[model samples]
Target: MPKTALLTDLQRLVRAYGVLAGTCDHERAIVGPISREWIASEVEQSVLLSSLPAELFDTQRGKDLLAAELYSDRNVDPRSIDPDTLDLSELCRDRVINSNRIPKLEPQINCAVLVANMLLGVRLYGNHGAGVPEISHDLIVAAMLQDALEKPYVFSALSSAEYEIVDADYIKTWFGPNVAMLSYQIRDALLAFETSSDSVVSSARIANSLAAIFASRLRLTARAAGDSVVSFLGTVRRAEVVKKGLDPDSSFPERPYLARDFELAEAALQLAGVDHYALREPVENTLMIAVKDALEDETKRSRLSGRRGKAVHELHINLPVMEYYVASESSNSLETVHLASFEMMRSLEKGRRKSLSTMVAHAFRISAFAERVLGDALEPLVITLAMLHDVVEDGSAAVTGFDHSLQKIMFRFGAPIAAMVSELTDSSVKTAGAHKARMTYEQPHLISPEDQYNVNRFTELDLRPSDGRQPYTLSGIVIKLLDTVVSLEEGIRDPELMTDWWRHSGARIFWADNMRGSIVHPLIERLVIELKQSRSDPEYALKPHRVNRGRLRAGRALLETTLNHLDMYTTQNLAILSDEYQLDESQREFLIRSFNDPNITEERFSKLVLDELLTEDRLCRAMDLGRVPAKNYVTLYKKSSVPEESSDKTTLLSYRGNALRRKAIRTELGLDTPEGITALSLRHEQVLSMYDQKMSSTELKLPCDTVEMVS
Candidate 1:
């Protein structure tokens, strides 16, 4: 038979078996106990003849192939033959006959049949037709018997039965060139599935699965390493249950695990030598249907429903909410980004207290902003960094020290993530020294000598570079911008923090201006407008007490003088400026000038600094921001308008409820103006974009159903 015809016949046979087994209790029972090997053979001649279309099996050659006894006795009833009860020699008899070679002891036959089936499935379903040779029975039979000649010791260890090892020459001499040539390919798929299965069953190997999964997902190279990425994910799921102080063997009600299965299936398929990218849409569609059915069943059982609300009320860190947030925010992000979000959340759970929700929200907001602004071209690097940007900096040093945390990130995630995080972390003693000197000069009473010593020691950890701070990568700069934007938003939403937020915003805006002409420039432009608008709001005006006003004026004066006199905006230069202005005649002159000026109102100073002093080209040169290469910046501004109302009533209701809550909060904060409403609407649109991306990516619609269930 031709290759296509043969594959079509085989696929029909498997599909027919699936349908028949679903309806027939006896067939189902027989399939339930045996391994995948016996199940492959379970597409018996009778099932083929009865279940498949008559035209498919009408040919005598097809019937002959299906009805061939091969090494097994044709007269025997398959229903009566118990695979578990069969002798090892009896299992090896087929391999012996197929290979036409006899070793001193029989080689193991554990994965031979399953590996053959998997290879055949890959040929049938994968996109290997253009350059691949035609399939033949010799190749199929070789695949089936390949495992018996290779991996003899592995099988012996697995089954606790002695087996003689066979060499490549034996395979070539006994089974011909096909088996010898294809044995390695068979071994790759075999070991991938085998190791994955082993990880699922063996307690000793469970801890290593997370690292394996992380490496596989990051590099897409775990297939050759004998690790099934999907299986590791499953093992990690169970491990998470254990971490939650629950029994690993017990059932856990969660949808993220199911969603992750769908999400990671493509990676698994790719590892198994399937052309997952080419088949992604169809494969995801099929898996989505299966998952939706599973979700319906879980919903009927009340397993997925109502749990989020209960968990929210009872748990400090509502995992379902967190998972939903991360999934939605990372829906359009890369696999690495998605994985990093989970890792960051796991790390945060160890050290964070009441600030857990705030931190998580902030991280996810940064991730969301990354996807919206940068798109997916640089998503893997930028989004991963965005998610983990604060793991070392914000985590409690007692729970996980800075080095330990950073090394763990490097080990689990990769060096690039750790490096970017280190760059982003404010861990340099040099930076601390600069901050300390500036603070001492600006407000000497605030930092006692002991506090200054602590700051110095904190910076001495050397988590970052030793010589000086390395310039930020374009990704690091984008993360910093997003972080600032999120902080500014938080400040805008909370009236009590307005004055402090304004001060911080001023510094950050200057930092942003110094980064003009980079990919983050557009974002900076938007931020400047928002800051200007927010600063103009009389409700959120800087109305500090007299003492704080004096301090603010002095700080502004110090900042302006430093910017005016400094040649380059490096930390070294800033430190020198602070020292010189503190000790020299310039110190008294600066203090006198700052206190003497009455026209430098907060608004006028901001206008002068933002509009006059810090033009784009000037600060860009002063800071040498263009030293780092710039990438094309993308924006979703047009896409940020409110999305069309979802056809899903449940989702629409949830969106409206969310909008109402946001409106209520803004109203309470006295920020319910037209611009505020428009900004919130844009945010609402951004969330819907994430929601849509997540729905498409996972191909699972649990969110709409989840909302209905929670309600």
Candidate 2:
């Protein structure tokens, strides 16, 4: 799918009108990426009296057909209506003549398409089992027209009397009463749909299905700025995840809460002029299961490749609707990433680095971090890089093999992604023996667990930064920084555990040192220098914009919070697990003596002895007490009125209310706590009061003392 195909004439026309009238950004996100084929097909088969073309709007016959389509009742004078009133000349003139408040045209187009398609989808597919109403094509045409007609009224460009002259009733008098009525209904529905939080699953499913069909029809490739096509696609994907009973939240990058499947489905159904119960269970069941299966199994679709003799899978916007059926597994964008990720997993299996699952997690987190900072526009590329970042180095891919991977990436995705991934692989990690080879097993030790701990803590390993390094491209730097952040986040979880886990390499250097040993060392150094300079150097500082600063700050905060929670959890686990086993005095003495002997150290010993000592009785008793993070801190608690107040007259009334208020205290902590919030409030109170008496000694006749109060 090429990017150009998604931008159709219908989209342009709709957007132009939307810009002139002004539509909300969220509404635009929903309204963009409508399928021209689907709309035309619906218009062709609709209960419409005629399918008027752009040119036909100029003819009397065209006006008659349009007027007929608009009004089912058909009580109107068509001859009195001038089709010229439907023309966009005034809107264009306004854009040309005016200097302020002009909306970006492309975004408007995308918004218009989304809204128009969604409206039609709701009308057609959102059946309440009363069967779809005799929906008129006027709804489709009126989508764009209504926005234009309402523009003057919306922007206050026309006065009340002037608006009345071209109001619904007036226009209907010239056009037709039915047309006017239908237009009002559509306009109202649009508003209701945008604002309402009601659930209507059938309508959402249908709307998503319609958008999927449109995406497939247009083969939408490139992301359009200010359009919700990318996000809409993501929403559909999330819906699929929900339909499959998967958690929609991304743990790697962390996402704010999203609505559940039932909620989303219900919302869609409501917007589509249908009730939830009206939807057939059989249809819903099939949509949930079979449609997804069909989407996953289908594999015949093809897409354009940047290289000759190489075609990739077409972008799949999977919908279970008969019209949306694509018989290719690779038809959708989700499938493409899934396939790539699967391949990456398999590659890691051959030469596993930090376990296949952990590596995959890293990839997901990296991609997620990228998406957070860069926005959705670069998500696909960023994710692809994350997936393949370690393949070449960790998988021990040959030069020729890497070249092939690069070629495959270029042909399948694009060059930009291939370039980024190429830069992500730290080739130095593979060439030098900074880290142990995958095949080389660690030497078994005769040390006791305590001795092993001592060795892990005291032994200094020869870890050094790679001297051979080069500069980094901006794209490469972005990915590496994200990679470093994610890696550190994981490594920070019990730094001791990490050191123990990689004990073979000694505890002196861990992730940071390991990174320094790789090709990314110089890049990290450069980044550090830049960051330090950025604090004081105006030229080196981040772009002077809230958006840029906010993204960086927010991303950092989220990463830190997540990292802290994970670290706390792991530390608790370690504390409990460590107490599970203990050596008796005599056994400990013998083991320590044996471990001290260099000859005995050469003999392999088993840590299994300690594991066996941790019987169920001991483990169960330890667990009975529970393990929780320490929470010995003070926090102010407030009450409107304490039933039993302390024996003190320091209480104060709340400013706005007459209710008595006082500070209280509470303390508690829990393990496995998923979520919560704590509030902090500040107050000032007098610590002490004093009374002082002053006497002027110089005044001979005055033995008077003056009293003063201090607060």
Candidate 3:
């Protein structure tokens, strides 16, 4: 929604203070002060809640709804879920339908959408996070209050129809994350100021000024929040203020207001989503109330005494909000620009250097969209990259105490997120150059190669096999490759820089050329200027660092492709495994011969053993009968004595009836062999023999589900 619309409504709401403002007419017998009692009563009253109009309850994919809660279901008595202690899994597995948060209408409609997913039964609907649901009331409520977003019928942007089910995309469009979650900091600052006793020197006046600053920025940050709860609630007060300003008497205006905010806390609680609602309230609500109190205090302060004299003075009080405002108001005012001289160096187009930051910022949309399309697999990395690409260092602020080196910043502040950032940074880093450059002559300097580091007291660079957490798994390695590839693609659009870049940086020229195009793009231009530099300077310090990145990329891609082609399992073994499914003699021989292959990966060996885990197949029978093959039943670890056989029949395992089968399994599988025996080497026949002996001895045995050996 437009800030203008919110302002328009809030202006009208200025009359909320009419009685206090002394603007109301006393001649007409009008009511007096608005009491806290009125607000209190309405707090519990059957406040009319707005729901996504009936027409938009979701027919297509990705629509969200507050579903019917668990405790509300009567058929599932309290006793059913808890046989002994409490729920074994999702207690309300079969029950749940998404609806609005209004309990009075039909408490049954409240269903929690799992935090990670919003699709049909994608989650185990029952309580998974909060203690296993033993009782009905245990079901969590995912209080997403503003499911219904009201828009003017005339607004052409309103899709499908007015009051339709909010599309997931629209949910983000309306109430999405604004400014890398900047409000969180403003919120923290607000909360700190609000709770602090005015018994000290810090003025509530300062807090109030800060609040206006935050509110104004919040308004800008939330510009994209369409029909979103945040958009509605954030704008609500302003809207009411506007309405009061327009007419000090007209009953509360309805234009785009969030009626359910009081009950559902707007949509902030939905951050955890539906899977767990009621449980999250106390924590989320605490945060909400704190921020609310801060907002109220600031609003009051602004009303009493407002408007500061200077920009720097305004910034002096609220650093975070003030900084955002200043940077926004004028480009010259930005104080936190990262020094990424590499993006501009060696490129002929000194002109593009000046606009490089802005262009790159725009370019992020490409990576963002790509990751969005990739969905769960890549989104987190993309979000992390977006934050780092611009925030950490593009070349303005020097990292000292307040501004550590970009590498250190990425490693320290982005500790939890460094892995992801490192994947996308495109550092190229061939032969480790000097990465640090102090501010010189007040000019930003891009660190260059050949500068020797103080290696004696340095953080040693190493990735030996013993290094834990190295990218060892297939997925881990793949992530590394993809991160670099995408970054290379991001810089490939311009070609002229690729040519001129080769001459300037010398060996570093590879950086620009690699970033220019696909594995093959013939560069023809020699001196096209790179974006982001002054025209007179002609050459920037760095050329997008794109070439060495290309070589590294080409190398990694080939490795991935080669790995993909190798056969990890033989056809004969697969055939043997399939035969085990059918049973009898000829099949058993095939299985034995298949195991004779000289080259089978451990993964395949593990798979074969799993397949015969629960069968009565003959080969497994041979292994059980002590027909052990060489290299089979490999030992994993060795221990001491096994527990002595118990005589007590009352014990579940000591019932005595299945003793023979247990003993047979103990022999073939090596009873709790103090020495850990890997199941991987256990041939198909060995697994079957154990199952056969058990089946024959026990009358009350349950049917097996799969052959994978659990023990």
Evaluate residue 527 in candidate 3 and report its C-alpha lDDT on the 0 to 100 scale: 8
lDDT tens string, model 2, 1-711? Answer: 112233332222222232332222111112332221211111101111112224434433334434443442768765465666654333222211110001111222232333343333334444642324443334443443444444332212112233332357543543345546655655554445446544232344333332322222121111111111122123333343355444534221101111122233334433443323323232233232332232233221111211110111111111112122111223224323433443454343212122111343455556655544443234333454566676555544231111235444444434444444555555455543222211111212111112211223222322122111323344444555566655544433212222112211111122233333233333333333333344456753444311234333433333333333223222222222333223343544343333223332121322322224323344345335532111100000122323232211111101101100001001111112333222111000000000001101111111111111111
Lowest summed lDDT window (length 10), candidate 1: 98-107
Candidate order by lDDT, highest to lowest? 1, 2, 3
List TM-score per model, in order. Answer: 0.26, 0.29, 0.22
Compute the lDDT for candidate 2.
0.31
Ranking by TM-score: 2, 1, 3
Root-mean-square deviation (CA) per prediction: 29.5, 30.5, 29.1
Give the 10-residue window scoring lowest on summed lDDT in candidate 2. Answer: 683-692
Index of the highest-TM-score prediction: 2
Q: Please provide, for model 1 over 1-711, each residue's C-alpha lDDT reduced to its tens digit, 9 standing for 90 to 100.
A: 111222322222222111121112111110112222222121101111122222222222212222333323466433243334434334333321110000000011212222232233333433433321233334444444432443332211112244334456645543455545655454454455445633222211111122122212211111101111111122323343345443423232333444344344434444432333223333333333334444455332221111121111112122122222232223323434434654564344222111112343456555544433442222356556766887776553322222236766655554445655775665545353233222222331222112222222332434452113333433444565566555434322221211211212222223323222122333223323333344465653453211133332322222222221111112122222222222233443342233223444445533443244323344234224432111110010111223332111222122223223333433443545687457544543433333234223331111110001111
| Model 2 bad stretches (over 4 Å) | 1-361, 371-384, 391-404, 428-469, 488-512, 515-524, 538-711
Residue-wise lDDT of candidate 3 within 1-711, one digit each (tens)?
A: 121222211111111111111111111001112222211111111111122222222211002121213333344432233222423124423332221121111010011111101111111222442322221111111111111112121112112233233333332333333311222333344345335422121332222223232222222111111112211221222243344432222332221221222122323223222223222332233323433332444222111111121111122222222112222122111111111111211000001111111222222333333232332233222333333443332321211001223455333322323333332233334311111000111123211111211122223433221122221122222333233333332222111121111111111212222322111111010001111132234343344432233322332332322111111111122232333233454555544443343354334534553344313344345435533221121111011212232111121111111222222333442233444224322423333443344324432212211111111
Between candidates 1 and 2, the TM-score winner: 2
lDDT of 1: 0.32
